[model samples]
Target: MCNTVKVSPRKLDPETRAALVDIAAKLLAEHGAEALSTRKIAAEAGTSTMAVYTHFGSMSGLVREMVHEGFARLERQFAKVRRTDDPVADMAVLGYAYRQNAKANSHLYAVMFGGQSLAGFSLTEEDRQYGRYTLLTVIDCATRCIEAGRFRQGDPRPIAHEMWIATHGVVNLELGGYLIDPANADRCYDGMLSSLLVGAGDEQRAVTASMAASKRRRRREVEVDPEPAEAVATRR
Candidate 1:
């Protein structure tokens, strides 16, 4: 599945090319990494196979575009919180956004950062530029937290990497089907975020709230009325 599949996307109009890229992203989000096929994308986009080839050059090229676009979206999400004066809060918000984006774009998330790559293709200058922008955004937030004494005094890059790993663990677990309780998402999110923040108290609040809610839900189910033997037999 990681082998290079030759195609092209160099000649399509800018609008059509953009549309095709979006269509590909949607398909990737709905399906897993295996859904990113030029033939399949062309069919879904109502265009010929040649169009994909003309615009993107190959499946490798298409994947590169997806990687670039994915990082761009990440950059935009971070940009929204760039002006927040509270570094600790900003970092937590960034963690939330990061998880939301990863869960929402699992396919692209898997392809770009999932550590698998196509043969003979490496990330290009443009790809690195987009990736650098993402890293810089993370570093910027972490650096601010460090500067404000909201985080430990150390190199912000490693701190940022650590935070990313912790946050990704949550998203990856959920994606891998290990995190089943939707009500526990807030608890899990806050628990992960608290490990990164130096002295945050909101984590306790979120955890307590989620745990209480989960308990109430379980108790409600236990207390619910049951069906009669005849109804049970009918269902069976």
Candidate 2:
């Protein structure tokens, strides 16, 4: 029998850990989840195969981290969105940011939702719940709108969820290149968000005019009046 060659574990640090995650994400996007073997990821990151085990314990552990990283990235993107005084307008900005992040990280976005690619990995309920925190940004906005007497009085989660569902569906289609005229996707996305805002009881005429003014003035990117996000990622 031939002797086995052992590789020493690479020194783990914040930078290295992040690099590994980024590399893994790229590999996942380029080759699909099945091709995300630890060996391949480590080699891409210029580390030994044992580094994966050292840093993340196992391939399954690394996949778990990948899911968490995707959600975490979204949280950070949405967190940067300016929460304008008008909760309805702010909600629209959040939707825009969501689409931007999805487009920028299309492959990771696909892997996050399309779990079929990683059929061999076993995910826990908690793992499935990892990204609920990001969804809360929508719910919190809906709550603000309701508190300001914009939406119908009730639990805001379901209503916000509908908005999220609509937004996600639109983004999914856009990313999948299903939009006939992708050039006009921005208009379509904005219009879709305006409709969702109206569905949540925002004044239809006001929302429409405000969105129009926003498009003209380009002041929509300035963040304002958003709820605190310090504890957002920690929430279930």
Candidate 3:
């Protein structure tokens, strides 16, 4: 005869889980994926290694959740972009939102974009699509631009994709310290976005006007609700 005792999984504590995820993301951003270890995350989070397992099952699960968190943040930023009559302006705002999300969550951003890879973890095709799901908002804005004749009459996916590629290139460079000068980086980013809009069949003057409008809207948002102290400290 054999006797067996079964142990149930620990219930997740949302606050503790969130804290651990945040600590993991910060460590990843500051020290790279190589620094991600269950022991280290537990230590930095002031919890036990068992907490990590309790919340995420494994380190890979934590990494996967980090990727989801990155996209979730971007989605929130997109949701904050108020829709305006000018679809072109809205598209530009989406681009700005994308950049802001990446900057604000650089730790998760790096992992989300494959800047670093977790050991024994690989994103499946479904996981990749989940990430791309965030771009649907941009595509919707692009579609509106096309309907309004602001962009060429064609499928909007490619236009949205090109915008994403160009924006990603600029952001990636900025993150890599290639665009060190703030003024230069801003110029480069704005110029690149403007060029993409123009190439997408919008008039140069209209593109400039749309981008200006987007900037103003972003400024208003910041004025209305300033960045938090913690975020400011992190940015600094």
- TM for every model, in the order presented, reads 0.70, 0.82, 0.87
Report the backbone clash tally of model 3: 0
Candidate 1, lDDT over the whole model: 0.64
Residue-level lDDT of model 2, residues 145-188, one tens digit each, is: 88888777889999878887888988988987799999999888
Error of 2 at 45 (Å): 0.7
Ranking by lDDT: 3, 2, 1
Candidate 2 regions with alpha-carbon error over 4 angstroms: 1-10, 213-236
**How well does candidate 1 match the true structure in TM-score terms?**
0.70
* Alpha-carbon lDDT, every model: 0.64, 0.71, 0.79
Which candidate has the highest TM-score of all?
A: 3
lDDT, residue 137, candidate 1: 75
Span of ten consecutive residues with least summed lDDT in model 2: 227-236
Screening candidate 2 with a backbone cut-off below 3 angstroms (N, C-alpha, C), the clashing residue pairs are 82-223, 82-224, 83-224
